[model samples]
Target chain A: MKFGVVTFPGSNGDYDSYAAVRFAMKEKVEFLWHKSEDLQGCDAVILPGGFAHGDYLRAGAIARFSPIMKHVIKFAKSGGIVIGFCNGFQVLTESGLLPGALLRNNHLRFNSKFIYIRVERTDTPFTGVCRKGEVLKIPIAHGEGNYYNFESDVRKLEDNGQVLFRYADASGNASAAANPNGSINNIAGIVSAEGNVLGMMPHPERAVEDIIGSSDGLKVFESVLNYCISPKPVGRL
Target chain B: MTTTAKTKKVIVYVRLKDGVLDPQGVTIQKALGQMGYPDFVSVRSGKFFELEIDAGASDIDRQINEVCSKLLANPVIERFSVEKI
Candidate 1:
């Protein structure tokens, strides 16, 4: 399956995501320009990281209105596969493709480090290859990764099993200390209600190679590829 | 009758919804406490935007409302108020 990595004007992680799919995953990949309103017939779309439109007003407020985003939103609503990482996650939430909002880190500082996140649910296409509760080491770099939502929406997300990843310790305990950005319930990643769209703060694409430290992130990419190869009805979450 | 276009200003205020955590505001409150201003009641941070529009723009209120809801504030955690200034 071909992967489309979107490149907004200020997107710095576009190349990284492209390399991960083209070289690491050995898959056909193309760069989708933000101003273009086309998906380029890709099976999956990746809204890679970086400060789009200079992150003015909010991290993703401007980029969410990009021309390509209109198509991205339509594509996602039609049950297409979309994964957003870092600033990409912010855009997804701002675009209403994902639930909740990302606020400034509780400590009001930009955090950059390798953190462990446990797969909360393996039913989604993004985590299909991982065992339930398995811990994956990934890097998170952001200033506003703190996730927030209305109390009722949080309950709905939990009930629907949409919460997919939570920051955790090596032992897989999602303790308060392990919560990197103080996301409610340590939520590091989540899938849309339909389970076709995923938004996560951590850069799984940055962790695909062992030489870079850990290859735990490759599992996520592989799971998506596997799901694409054999299309099946996804469990609503 | 001939009408000339005039410039009008609209002010928009955006704030996080109640119960939503405001880390920047919290940090400011903490700093205030450290500065020996313990009596400070509270602090909540917010943002605003000033827009200039044509005075004769049709459905000006509706246009401002749409902009506020669609871009100025994120409905999930923020609320926005618009006023013709």
Candidate 2:
């Protein structure tokens, strides 16, 4: 399926996302500028990581008002596929397409390193190719990766199986030590209530090739392709 | 007769909700303790914005409130107060 990677001002990871889709996944992909209101008839969209609009006011706050986002929001609400990584994740939360918010790391330091995350659920389109409880080594680079939400909302996300990935050890233990950013419940990634939009702090695009580090992230893209090609009734499994 | 709209300056103060965690505020509090200000038991960091709006516009208060809630602050984890000077 064709993918549209949006490039907002100061978006540094757009190229990485585009290359991952075009070269690694061997899928048709195009760059959607922030000002462009068109989706270009793409099957899926990716909001790559970066300090959009210089992260003014707040991360993703300004970017959410961009012209392209109006269409993206409508596309997502209509059951279209949209995946956001890092700052893109922040954008998703700010746009109200996803629940919860990303906050400053409890340590007040920027973290950039490889970390392990366990697949909490594989029923969603984003993780269909991942095995239940499978741990993937992925790198996270962000200062405001700490995720926060109301206690009641978090419970709803958990009850509905919206929590898709969590910081974990190699053995698939979702322990506090494994959580690099102090996200509530070690949540590294989560899907929307409808399971069409995914917001994750980890940079899976950077891990698509083994030369960089691990190829486990490819499974995420593969999962999307699998679901789009022949979508099954996606519900809590 | 054409009339000019009056310009009013409004201030918006934004703070994290009472129970939400504020890591920057915690770090500042730690530094304050180290610097011998033990009496400063708490530090909750926040930000403010100054806006100039058309005072003659209809429902000026409502407009300011809308901007504060929709842009200046995220209602999920923050609360905001508006002051018209």
Candidate 3:
């Protein structure tokens, strides 16, 4: 499976994501710079973490207008799985690829730690490998990760099973201790209406290495691989 | 000899309105009080943007207005003011 990791000017996690894909799936992952409009025939794309554009303006404001973003948006609209992590999530939000704005952390500090996130729903392509109620430990580092959307939108997410994951304790119980950023409704991540594009604040790539601690994130990549092998429809619209 | 060029400074502050709950501001105020700055007053936080644009052909006022309205302010709960300092 060909994976494309988009790199913004300040993107730091694209390399880590490349390494993760190589180690787990043994594939020659491609690096798609934010400026390049050409994707070079990638099956899926990932927007990795880091302070894109030095996080100037807003976290993902400038990066959302990158030339490649137009292609990424179309790719996602065509039923491609465009998963965004950390800063990537911000970009998706800014570009209207995802809903909800990420406000400053409720704690008013940068959070960097492995926190438990329960699989709130698995009906999407990104979370199909994860079982509902399964809790995975993922590290998050960001000041603006508090997700806030209109109450109607939040309810729609819950009703449609678009809320894929929530911060929860290791035992799979959801609570403030598990919710790192005090995101509204404790939402750690969510998917688009079609369940193809997902934007989440947690870093799943960092959790793929066993020696680092728990590799619960492998489940996410594994789910992607399974999706790749599965007979995906021809091309995106 | 060529003359040096200079641009005016623009200050834009975005703050939560009255009656709005600003958890970040509250936390900072609490922390300040805890640090023994008992005299510290209320702290309502917002964004400060310094924009330097080529005011040659474009309308500076229009550009600045677009920047503030479209990007700087969320327009839902936040208010902003821009001044040339």
The lDDT per prediction is: 0.91, 0.93, 0.82
Candidate 2 lDDT, A1-237, residue by residue in tens: 899999999999999999999999999999999999799999999999989999999999999999999999999999999999999999999999999999998888999999999998888898888889999999999999999999999999999989999999989999999999899999999999889999999999999999999988899999999999999767753
Best by TM-score: 2
| Native A-B contact fraction in model 1 | 0.89
* TM-score per model over all chains: 0.96, 0.97, 0.85
TM-score of 1: 0.96
* Model 3 DockQ vs. reference: 0.31
Candidate 2: where are CA atoms >4 Å away?
A: B1-5
Arrange candidates by TM-score, highest first: which order? 2, 1, 3
Flag regions of model 3 displaced more than 4 Å.
A231-237, B1-11, B16-23, B31-42, B50-62, B74-85
lDDT, ranked from best to worst? 2, 1, 3
The TM-score obtained by model 2 is 0.97
User: How large is the C-alpha RMSD of every model relative to the true structure?
Assistant: 2.6, 2.5, 4.0
Give the candidates in order of DockQ, highest first.
2, 1, 3
Interface DockQ per candidate: 0.78, 0.81, 0.31
**Which is superior by DockQ, 1 or 3?**
1
lDDT per residue as tens, model 3, A1-237: 799999999999999889889886587689998899798788889999999999887789888889999999999898887989999999898888888778778777898888888987665556667887998988888888988777788898888777788988889887877788878788999888777888899999899877886788888877777777694432221
